[model samples]
Target: MRSNVLGSAADFRRGGHSSRRPLDSHLAQLFMRDLRADAPPQLPIFRSRLQGELLARLLLGPDREHTMLDLAVMLRTDLGSVVREVDRLARAGLLTLRRTAAGRLASRDTATPLHEPLAQLVMHTFGPKAVVAEEFGALPGAAEIHLFGAWAERYSGVAGEPPGDVEVLVVGAVDPGAAFDAAQESAARLGLPVHPVVRTVGEWRDDTDPFLRQIRACSLVRAR
Candidate 1:
């Protein structure tokens, strides 16, 4: 049933056009068809780290509304950079900006055809580390946090897709149960699996096992 609708939409894309049906409608249908079949389309690679980070926070983070000034401070980037990135994302149909009494506000464009799927992918790829840093930093016993595996490699600019699960290492005397509970909460919120390996500072420093050695040698994103 869905395929027939998609076939008609594809035909429209090829040539057919009507005054009653607008271009955006056809495009939305086409995008919906694609979403029905596979993962979301890939977003363009961002040249600026701050730009990427900003988008991830807007779409994947818990909050929906942010003023440009607030975003600049939160991302620790300059106001100019934040404005530029917001403009770029707006042009790309990935974000929506509106003028509010407080300031220029930005939020994800859920109305866009590809919004939900693209958001899921972005959150799965970049959201874990952000969530880990935000959620665990305040834990009483946590001393340090690290992200390893494919996500870490990609974050270090090695190039990789979002992995099935995020790998996290916590160095502290934190209760394993508490840490795992935190992981579970983060996972539920981020729409991705979170695998946390909790170890004492001494255990992490020992690095005796081959896996530990490899993880220690590779690029790691320190969450704390």
Candidate 2:
């Protein structure tokens, strides 16, 4: 399995369980597809470039309201650095400062305007049907469950104006074989590879699962 796709050599490697595609996901081999051109341009918010990406990711959803200490650990920086970044975000008008006992840390107050561009890219290039099929629409019980990760990241990442396209790894229910088939077909139809690893609630065990373990090591993109 590939490890910490954003931080490790895995991003450069040709193939892996996470990176590989079945015939159905895109319907054909992903063949030399370099989509950087199709991806969005970097934002000015990331310009001050003080690990603001982490701040952006944290703000993507209401769920990941991390403390200053949490941001400290995630950035592999000191509390002071995290605090500084929070201040930067506040000054940029992207965040509002909220105080608990933890000094001045910024609170996410609004939806990012940056999200739609990436979603639009996915929807435009791949088409909404494929985005929904390869993403939310086709997944069985996705509405019933949390239905996140690789798919949710489309909104979360772009919505957060993350450093890159949303890369998701979600948990949901499906007839394992059929779901996989749909994912394959959807990807083929979209002309790009969309990867997903679905496990049932009962089947989704501890971090020992290869994917989760890699994720634990470096889902730098996962808000927290």
- Misplaced by over 4 Å in model 2 are 1-45, 48-50, 111-224
Please give the lDDT score for candidate 1.
Answer: 0.70
Model 1 CA deviation exceeding 4 Å by range? 1-92, 95-126
How far residue 8's Cα lies from its native spot in candidate 2, in Å, is 33
- Candidate 2: tens digits of C-alpha lDDT, residues 114-146: 444433443333332324343445566652222
TM-score of every candidate: 0.48, 0.34
User: lDDT (0-100) at residue 122 of candidate 2?
Assistant: 32
Q: What is the lDDT of candidate 2?
A: 0.44
> How high is the lDDT of residue 99 in model 1?
96
